[model samples]
Target: MSDALSEAIPVLLVAAPILAATLPLVFGLRFDRAGWLFTTLTTSSLFVATVVLATVVYSEGTVIHQLGGYPRAYGIELVADRLSTTIALLVTGTSAGVLAYTRLGGPRGNTFYSGYLLLVGGLLGLTFTGDVFNMFVFLEITGLATYALIASGDGPESAVAGLKYLIVGTVGASLYLLGVGLLFMATGTLNMIELAEAIPQAQGGYENTLVRAAFAFVFVGFAIKVAQWPVHAWQPDAYQHAPDGVTPLVAALVSTVSAYALARVMYTVFTVDFLTQTPYAREIVITVGAVSVVAGSTLAVIQRDVKRMLAYSSVSQFGLVVAAYGLVTETALVGAVIHLVGHGIMKAGLFIAAGVIALGYGARTVDEYAGLAARRPVVAGGMAVLLIALIGIPPSVGFVGKWYIALGAVQAEVWSVAAVIFLSTMLTLAYSARLLEKMYFTPANWLEDPHAPDADVVATDGGSGPGLTRQSDRARPDAVSIGMLSIVVVAAVLAVALGFSGDLFYDWLEPFVSEVFN
Candidate 1:
C-alpha cells in the first residue's frame, strides 16, 4: 500500500463512527431513528475495516499511520500492530453484537442507539490512536458516552452510578494528562515509538527525574482507568447499575482497552529494558497485577448482583493479563495479548446475558438466576458458555488464555502467583457452576412439588430473573428474542472456534512476542 493509504488506516477506522455520530445527532434532532441507521452503518463498516486491518497487520507486520503526513519522529502516529488491531477488532466486533441485540430486543429509541454508537466510536478511537495526548481526548469522549449510556437506565441508581463513574473518570483523565505532560518534558515527543526510543537515553541525563515521574503518573493513571486493585472502587456499582443494554459494552471494551493501553505503555514505551533500568518499576506493575487478581476475584465471589460479579471478574482477569505482560518473557506477553482478546469475548457475552435477564424480569441477583435455563434456555445456555469460558474450562477460548498465562507463570517460576491463579480458576468454576446448578438444577423444595397435595406453583414468570419466564400454571416464554439468540450464537461459536485456532494464534503471536526485546 502507498504511504498515504497506510497513514489513513487508523483515522479511517475512527472516522467511521465520528462521521456517523454527527450526522445522526444533527439530522435526527427529534427522532432517535437516526441512531439505528447510523449505528448499524458505523459498526458494520468498522467490523469490516478491522478485519482488513488485522489481515494487513498479520501479513505485513505493524501498520503505522502518521497524521498530516509528517515525518515519523515529528508527527503523531498510529501504529496498528497485531496487538492494537487484535484489541481493536474485539472492541468493534463486540460493540456490533451489542448494538444489533439492543436494536432488535431493546428499547426502540434513537437516543439510546446514538449514544451506543458514540460510545463504540470513542472506544475504537482510543484503541487505535497513536498519540498519548490524543488518547486522552478519545478517552474523555468514551467516558462521556459511557456516563450517558448508563444514566439512560430507568432507575435513579443508574444515574448515581454514572455520576460516580464520571467523577472517577475525570480524575483518571486528569492524571493521564499530567503523565503526558511529564512524558513530553522527559522526551519532547508524544509519539509512542519515539518516546520508547528516547526514554532509555534519559536514564542518567537531566531528563531522568522527569522520566521517572512521568512513568509513575502514567502507570498509575492507566491503572485507575483499567481498574487495577486500589483504584477499582468505582467498578462494581458502575457496572451493575448501568442500563442492561450498556453493561457489556463498558465491561468488554472500556476495561479491555484500558488494559491494552497499560500493556502498551509498559512494554512499548517503558520497554523491558527500561524496567530493568528504572528503579522498582517492574515491581510496581507485577505487584499491582498480582494484588488485583486476588482482590478482584475475592470481591467477585461476594457479589450477589450478576453484573457486579462479572465486573469484579473483569478486574481480576485484566490484572492477570497485566501481570503476565510484566513478566516480560517470550510467551508471557503473547499470553497477555491473547487474554485481552479472550476476556473481551467472554465478558461481553456474560453481561449481555445479564442484560437479557434484567430486561426479562427486573432481576439482578445471583440467587434470582435460579431456573433461568428453564425460562430462557437460549440466553441461559449462552451465559453458561461464557461463564465456563471465564473459568478457563476446556474447549473454550478462556482456557486458551489461561493456559498461556499459566505457562508463562510456570516458565518464570512465579509459583505463588501461579497458585493464586489456579485458586482463582477454581473460584471461577465454583461460581460458574453455581449459576449452572441454579439454572439447570434448582432445588426441589424451591420448585413446586408438581406431585405434592394441593401444590400450587404460582405463575410469576417462572421465578428465575426476567425474560422468557414461565409460570407454573401459565404459558412459558417460548424463547429469547432472535437478537439475543444471535449474540449467543456468535459468542458460543467463537468460544469453541478459538480453541481449534490455537495454532493460528500461536503463529500470529509468536513473532510479535519474540521480537519484543528488539
Candidate 2:
C-alpha cells in the first residue's frame, strides 16, 4: 500500500465510528431498530479497515498520520504501530462479533447502539492517538459511553451500577489528566513521542518530583481503570449489573484498553530508563501487580455470583499484564501484549457464554450452574474451554501468554513475581474448577417449570444475601440465538488456535518491543 493511503486508514478508522454514531439517533426517527444494522455494517467495515491497517503495520512498519499536515509537536498524530494496530484490530473485531449476540439478546435501541459505536470510536481513538491530552479526551468519551450503556440495563440496579462507574471512572480520568498536566509542566509537550524525548531532559531528569509524582498519579489512575485490587470497588457492580450483551463488550475491551494505555505511557512516554533509574518506580509497579494478582484471585474464589467471579478474574488477569510491564524485558513485554489480546478474547467469549446460559437455562450463580453441561452442552462446553484457557492450560492462548510472562520473570530473576504467577495459576484453577465441577459432576437442579412465573428471575446481588431480582424484561430473550451460540464456539476455537501462533505473535511484536527497549 502507498504511504498516504496507509496514513489515511487510522484517521478514517477513528472518524467513521464517531461520525456514524450520530446516524443511529438520526435514523431512529423513521426506523424502530436501525441502530443494529448500522452498527453491524459500520463495525464490519471497521474490522476490515483494521485488518488492512494491521497488514500495513506488520509488513511496512509503524504508520504515523499527522493531522492537517502539521508537525507532530503541534498537530494531533494518529499512530498505527504494531502495538496500536493490534489493539485497534481487537477493538474493531470484538465490537463486530458482540453484535451477533446483541442482535437477538438485547438492550436494543438506537440509543444503545449509538453509545456502542461511540464507545468503539473512543477505543479506536485511544488506540491510535499519539497525544496524551487526546488520549485523555478519548478516555472520557469511552467512559461516558460505557456509563450510558451500563445504565441501559433492565433494572434500577443497572442505573446504580452506571452511576457508581461514572463517579469512579471520572475520578480515574481526572487523575490521568492531572498526570498529563504535570508532564506538560515538566516537558512542555503532550505528544507521546515528544514527551519521551523531553522527559529525560526535563529539570532534574528522572528524579524530578514532577516526573515521579506524575507517574504516581498516572499509574494509580490506570490502576483504578484496570480494576486493580483496593481501587477496584466499582468493577464487580458494573460487570454484574450491566446488560449481558453490554457486559461482554465492556469486560473484554474497556479495561484491556486501559491497561494498554498504561503500558504505552510507561514504556513509550516514560521509557524503561526512567523506571530503571528512578528509585522504587519498578518496585512499586511490580508490588502493586503482584498484590492485585493475589487479592483478585482470592476474591474470585469466594464469589458466588458468576459474573462477579469473572469480574475479579479480570483483575487477576490484568495484574499479570501489569506485572509483566514492570519486568521491562522484551520477553515480558511480548507476554503482556499477548495476554492482553488473549484475555480480551477469552473474557468476551466467557461472558457471551454466560449470557447464553442465563438466557437458556436461567443460571447466574455458581451453584445455579449445576449440570449445565447436560442441559446447554454447547455453551457449557465453550465456557469450559474458556475457563481452562483462563487457567493457563497448555496449548491455549492463555498458556502462551503466561508462559512468556513466566519465562520473562525467570530470566529477570524476579522469583517473587514468578511465584505469584504460579500461585495465580493455581488460584485460577480453583475457581474454574469449581464451576467446571458444578457444570459436569453435579446433578441438574436448575431445570425450572416453564409455567412458573418466577422461573426466569435470578438474583442480581453477587451472593451477598437476598438481593434485587433481575426480572425477565423485553430486553432479554427467552432463547439463545444461533449467532450467539456461534460466537461462543468461535471464541473457543480461536483461543486454542491462537495458542499455536505464539511464535507469530512474538515475531510481530518484536520490532515494537525492540524499538522501546533498545
Candidate 3:
C-alpha cells in the first residue's frame, strides 16, 4: 500500500462504523427489518477495512493519520500500528461474528442494532485514536452503548445490571479524564506521542508529582474498566443479565478493548523508560495483576451461574495480560497482545455456547449442564473444546499466549510471577473441570426429585417440564438457529488453528515490539 492509502485506512476504520451507526435508526423509519441488514453490512465492511489496515501495518509500518491534515504536535491523530490494528481486527471480526447469533437469536430491533453499531464505532475509535483526550471521548461512547445494550434484555434484572455498569464505568472514565488533565497540566499536550516526548523533559521529569499522580489515577481507572478483582463487581451481574445475543459481543470485546487501551496508555503514553526509571511502578503493576489472577479464578470456581463464571474467567485471563506488561520485555508484550486477542475469541465462544445452551436446553449452571452433550452434541463439543483451551491446553490459542508470557517472565527472572503464571492453569481448571464433568459424566435425571412436593416442581415453557426453575427458561429454544451454532464452532476451530500461528504473530509484531522496547 502507498503512504496515502495507509493514512486513509485508519480513518475509514474509525469513521465508517460511526457513519453506519446512524443508518439503522434512520432506516427504521421505513422498514422493520432494516437493522439486521444494516448491521451485517456495516460490520462486514468494518472487518474488511480492518484487514486492509492490518495488511498495510504488517507489510509497510505503523500508519499514522493526522486528522484534517494537521501536524502530529497539535492535531488529533489515528494510529494503526501492529498492536492497534491487531485489536481493530479482533473488534471488527468479533462484532461481525456476533451478528450471526443475533440475526436469528433475537433482541432483534432497529434500536438494538443501532446501539450495536455505536459500540463497534466506539471500540474502533478507541483502538485507533492516538490522543489521550480523544481516547477518553471514545471510552465514554463505548460505555454508553454498552450500558444500553446490557439493559435490552427481557427481565428487570437487566436494567439493574446496566445501571450498575454505567455508574462504575462512568467513574472509570472520569478518573482517566482526571489523569489526562494532570498529564496535560504537566506536559501541556494531549497527543500521545507528544506527551511521551514531553514527559521526560517536563519540569521535574520522571520523579515529578504530577506525572506520578497521573499514572496512578490512569492505571486505577483502567483497572476498574478492565474489571480486575475487587473492582470487578459489575461484570458478573452485567454478563448474567444481558440479552443472549448481546452477551457474546459485550463479553468478547468490551473489557478486552479496555485492557488494550490500558496497555496503549502505559506503553505509548508513559513509555517503558518511565516504568524502568520510576519508583514502584513495575512492582505495583505486577502485584495488581498477580492478585487479580488468583482472586478471579477462585471466585470463578465458586460461581453457580455459567455466565457469571465466564465473566469472572475474563478477570483472570486479562490478569495474565496485565502481568505480562509488567515484565517489560518484547516477548512479554507480544504475549500480552496475543492473550488479549486469544481471550477475546475464547470468551466470546464460551459465552455464545452458554447462550445456545440456555436457549436449547434451558441450562444455565454447572448442575443444569448435566448430560448436555447428549442433548446438543455440537454445541457441547464446541463448549468443551473452548473450556479446555481456556485451561491452557496444548495447541490452542490460550496455551500459545500463556506460554509466551511465562517464558518472558522466566527470561526476566521473575521467579514468583512465573510461578503464578504456571499455577494459573490449575486454578482455571478447578472450575472448568466442574462444568466438564457435569456436561459429560453426570446423568440429567439427577436434576429431578421423585420425592419432592408438587409445588416445588412447576411448569416451565408450556408444560414441557415440572422441574427446577432456571434463569434461562426465559428464552425459547425454537428461536435458536443454525447460524448461532456455526459461530460457536467457527470460534472453536479458530482457537485451535491460531495456536500454531504464534510465529506469524511474532513476526508481524517484531517491528512494533522493537520500536517500543529497544
Candidate 4:
C-alpha cells in the first residue's frame, strides 16, 4: 500500500480544472481575462499532469491514489493504470488543444472558456475515479458543462438542443444513480473493487430479477449518454447547433468517454463472468451496436450539413466501440479501446477542420466546397487526410483501429456486425468523396457569393476585410484562427503517426484487455 502511494502521480489531475472551474464564477464578474487565464493555466497544467501520469504508468505500472486519505468505501480514489492513464492523457491533451482553438476564435465572449474548463476537469475526474458515487458526481459536472457549452453556440436552436440534452442527461444520470443504489443495497458496499468481489457470491444465487433490472437501467442510461442509435435524435441537433470550435470536443470527449464508462462498468463492476451469465446481456449490446452503425451511417449520407454528417459518423463509430465491448472477446475489446482513441483523433480533427472551412467560405453542403484546396491548401488538405482516416484507410490511426475491430468481428463470426461495419465504411467513403470531389474537381465559380446569397451574414475576425462589419455579427472569421490551424496540424500528425505506433501500442493494450476474463 505504501509502495502504491509512492508511485502515485497525476493525483492533482482534478485539482487544476476544479480550481479553474471556480475561478471563473469568482472573478468572471470583474474581468473576463482572469477567467481565460485561469482556464488556460489549469487546462495546460492538467495536460502536463496527465502526460506525467501516462509516462509513469507506462514505465512503472499502475498508480493508485486515495482521495482525502480515506480508505476504500470511504474516500474517492484515482487509479492510473495503462488504460486509465491513456484515456486521461487523451482527454486532457484534446481538451487543451480544443480550448486553445476556441480561444483563438473568441469563444470566451460567454462562459464558454469557463464551462469548457470545468467540463475538462469533470471528464478527467470521471476517467480516474475509483468510487462509484464519485463517478456519478463527476459525470454531472461534465454533463452540465456540456449542456452549457452547447447552449452557448451560434443561435436559439442551441438553447433548444441544450434543453433536450439537459432533460435526457438528467434522467440518465438519475437512472444510473438508482442502479448504483441497488448494488449498494445488495452488497452493503459502494467501492467498485469490493462490489466486484462481493456481487457474485451473494445469497440466493445472485442472479435475481432485481440485479438484472439494475444492470439494464444503468447500462441503458449510459447507452443514452453515448447516443446509442434510437436514442440519438438529440446528437445531430446538438452537433449542428454548437459553436464550430467546440463541435470536435463534444464528438471526441463527451460521447467517447460515455461509451468508455459503459464498457468499464460491464467489465470492472459486473465482471465478464457475471455479464456473460446474465441472460442476453452481450447479445443485446451487439444487436444495438450493429443497428447504430447502420442507422447512423444511413442518416449521415442524406445530410447536407457537414457538421450533422460528421455527427452521425461519430454515432456510427461509437456504435462500433460499443459493439466491440459486447463481442465478449479480448481482441474485440482491445479494438474498442484503440478505436476510441483513433476515432477521437479522426472525428475531432474533421469537426475542427469543417468549422475552419465553414467560417472561411460560408460553405456547409457537399456541393459548395468547390476548389477549396486551391485557396487554402493547408486546411483543405488537412481535412482530406482526416476524412480518409475517418473512413479507415491504411497508414492512418483509423486503419489500425478498424483492423483490430474487423479482426475481432471475424473471430466472433458476427457476420451481420461485420457487414454493417463494412457497409458503413462504403457510406463513409461516398460522403467523404463528395467533399473531396467538390474540393478538387468542381470549379471555383460555383461557390455562392457570401454577400449575394445572404446579406445578413456575420463577419468574424478572419473574414472579408477590416471594414466588413455587420450590426448582427457574432463571428470574426472567414477562416479559422492560427491556434485552430496549429491544433489541426497536431491532430493530423497524430492520425498518421498512430499507424506506425500500432504494433507496439496494441501489444501493450492486449494484456490489459485480456485481464477482464481473469
lDDT of 2 by residue, 221-302 (tens): 9998998888999999999999999999999999999999999999999998998898888888889899999999999999
Task: List candidate 2 stretches off by more than 4 Å.
Answer: 446-478
lDDT of 4 at 190: 71
On lDDT, the leading prediction is 2
Please, what are the lDDT tens digits per residue for candidate 1 over residues 437-457?
877888424443331112343
Q: For candidate 4, lDDT tens digit of each residue in 1-518?
A: 24544445555777677767777777878886676677677777777767766666666777888876788876777776777777887788787777656765645553677788788878887888777777789889989999999998656778999999899888888888888887777777777777788788665435866567768888888878898889888888889888777788888899877877787778888888877787798889988898888889888888887889888888888888888888787777877888899888887888888877776666666766777788778888889988888888888888787778878888988877778778878988988888889888877763253421233444333356432332123223443678777778788889988877777877777656767778
lDDT of 2: 0.91
In model 1, which runs have C-alpha deviations exceeding 4 angstroms? Answer: 1-3, 29-32, 203-207, 443-479
Error of 1 at 292 (Å): 1.4
Q: Number of backbone collisions per candidate, in order? A: 4, 0, 0, 9
| lDDT rank order | 2, 3, 4, 1
Q: Estimate each model's TM-score.
A: 0.90, 0.95, 0.96, 0.92
> 215-310, model 3: which lDDT tens digit per residue?
999999999999987788999999999998999899889999999999999999999999989989998898889888989999999999899999
Evaluate all candidate structures by whole-model CA lDDT and list the values in order.
Answer: 0.77, 0.91, 0.89, 0.78
Between candidates 1 and 4, which one is better according to lDDT?
4
